[model samples]
Target: MTEHTGSYYAATVNKATDYPPLIGDQSADVCVIGAGFTGISTALHLAERGYDVQVVEANRVGWGASGRNGGQLIGGISGEQKVANHHKRDVEDLFGELRWAGHAIVRERIQTYAIDCDLKYGYLDVAIKKRHLREFEADCRRLEKSGFPHEFRMLSKSETSETIGTDAYLGALLNMGNGHLHPLNLCVGEARAAESLGASIYEQSPVLDIEKGHRAKVVTERGSVTADFVVIAGNAYHALERQLRGIMFPVKSFIIATEPLPENVVAQINPRDLAVCDPNFLLQYFRLSADKRLLFGARFNYFGEDPAVIRKSHRKKMARIYPQLADARIDYAWGGTIGVPINRVPQLGRISPNVFYCQGYSGHGVNVTHLAGQIMADVVAGTAERFDLFASVKPLVMPGAHLLWKPMVALGILYYQVKDRL
Candidate 1:
């Protein structure tokens, strides 16, 4: 059975899951093939609406990207513009509430289910270049025009340094609507909530095939699920379906956690406890963990999981921003894969009449996955307005991209690294 990666989130999980693997034939109103955020979120949504849901997983809950991400609750879909252009609709009319719809679902679940995942408001979109600040000006205007209730403002260079204790960025845009949380705990908590509502979850049962028909049969190693509908929520980790292959590239990202800092150190850096991300294709993001450790992540060319290697590269980058952390002891380091579509849009469509699939959130999985779950439930219930909006845009497929993903991703990262410098 596949286990959760050696991530800080995993080590500090509220509770480890030991769900039984699939064993025999089963039936349900819907069978979701994944236990990550998308699957659990969908299952929880369906259970709330009185659907008999069965979820099959290849590993423990939140083991994939859903559990091992940067945990940034960033607002907005990845590629909303492309969707708007393709449909010839105004961007705001196409996606205003839809952009932050996932954030609303997350907040509601945390409160309704009493989930304790170190939820906090405040985020920074730091600018590494002057052009980025101009972009922020436009974003701020849009927020103001929309009458965004949350506190948001653009910070000057000096103000940005004062806020994050880093002069690496020229400026920043602070958005309270966007924040961070403990993703693994949130995912596990949601799964537990689904269980309480009568949804069945089978972990460590990797799906082998899907026999599409009136009622699709999701085949696993030891058992099979024949449901009226099947939902494929496995993003980057799943490779069983041929239809999904080559549609998106799997990009690897790594993160390192520092030991809990001294109170003075914490106050000196990130006193407000805000998540920080720079505006770059090959960007860097960091936030203080609930225990006060700095969790930093970035995309590099390395594909291996050796913590030592990850720490060596990330520590250097971290120190470049905060010199005081130059000697800080690194406690944990890990990596995960993200499904990045070529066009940067979230891929939501049908593999068959009753077999639905959703993937490719780029790096915005935490917030978007929750909204996607709701949309998936809506699609199952005959409401496809939101689903159709995303489904209308066909994925820009790269032939044999999956087979040669490693080299392709490496080249892409190199290209972005060059672009970021320009």
Candidate 2:
């Protein structure tokens, strides 16, 4: 079995999963690929509706980006504006409710299943540049126009510092509708819920190929599963589907977790327990853990998984935002890959009539994946209204990009870093 990475999430998971790998031929109403948020979420949705579902994963549940993400339960899908524009509809008119649909699902599931993932409310979209503040103002207006239920408002430079104990941001937009949580715990809890509903999840069973037919066959090394439909939810870790490659760039993001801070430090920094993020394309995000550790994340040039190397680079970055944390001990450091489409849209399409795929959430996986799962479930049941909205905007494939992704992503990040400064 491919073990979970040496992440703080792994060390603190509620219950470690040890599902048996696929060992023989099996059948189900639907066979889902990958066990991260996307696949597990889809399986739970399908199982709830009484579909016989099975999920296959190369590693443990949420072992990929789902387990290792910054855990910001952000709202709004990436490239949503482009998707709405392609249909000649105003974004808010078309997706005002749909954009926050995933957030609703997350909240509902947490309540229904009693999943304790340190889920918290309140988030700050901090601004380092004037343009970001303008964008936040636009966002605030949109929220008001939608009759958004949560308490939300813009904060001035001094108010921002007072709220978060940081003078690094010029201003910020505080939204209680969005938040953060323990992503891995939520994923595993949902997986357990799906299992309770009779969904069969096989861990360490990497899909080798898909034989397309009226009943598609999902082939693994030790076994195979025949199902009426197959949904690919691997995201950036996927490698079996040749057609799915090149449609998105694999971008690496790193995070560092500090030792539980002293009560005084926690009081002076993030006492309200809000998830904080910047507006840059190469963004920096941080929040307090349930135990009061500061979990900070950003995009760095390195791609390896050496904790020492990650800590060295991220400590400097974190110290910049909170200089008092300069000597603070970092307890954990890790990295994970996220899919970034060329146009920033989440790609939802099919390899064949019965073989569907959903990937490339950019950095919006934590929120968008839940919505994608429901949409995938709807698609399998012959309802494609929401599915068509995303699929209609075809993915812009970059030829030979996956093979050269290392250098390609490096250039792209360098470009964004320069742009973030402007």
List model 2 lDDT by residue over 13-123, tens digit each. Answer: 999999999999999999999999999999999999999999999899999999999999999999988998899999899889988899999999999999989999999
Stretches > 4 Å off in candidate 1: none
Q: Write the per-residue lDDT of candidate 1 for residues 1-422, one digit (tens) a residue.
A: 67888999999999988889999999999999999999999999999999999999999999999888888999899999999999999999878888899999999999999998999999999999999999999999999999898999999999999998888999999999999999999999999999999999999999999999999999998999999999999999889888899999999899999999999999889999999998788889999999999999998998889999999999999999999999999999999989999999899999999999999999999999999999999999999999999999999999999789989999999899999998
- Candidate 1 minimal-lDDT segment of 10 residues: 92-101
How does each model score on TM-score?
A: 0.99, 0.99
Alpha-carbon local distance difference test for all models? 0.94, 0.94
> What RMSD does model 2 have?
0.7
What are the C-alpha RMSDs, in order, of all predicted structures? Answer: 0.7, 0.7
Clashing pairs in 2: none
Candidate 2: misplaced stretches above 4 Å? none
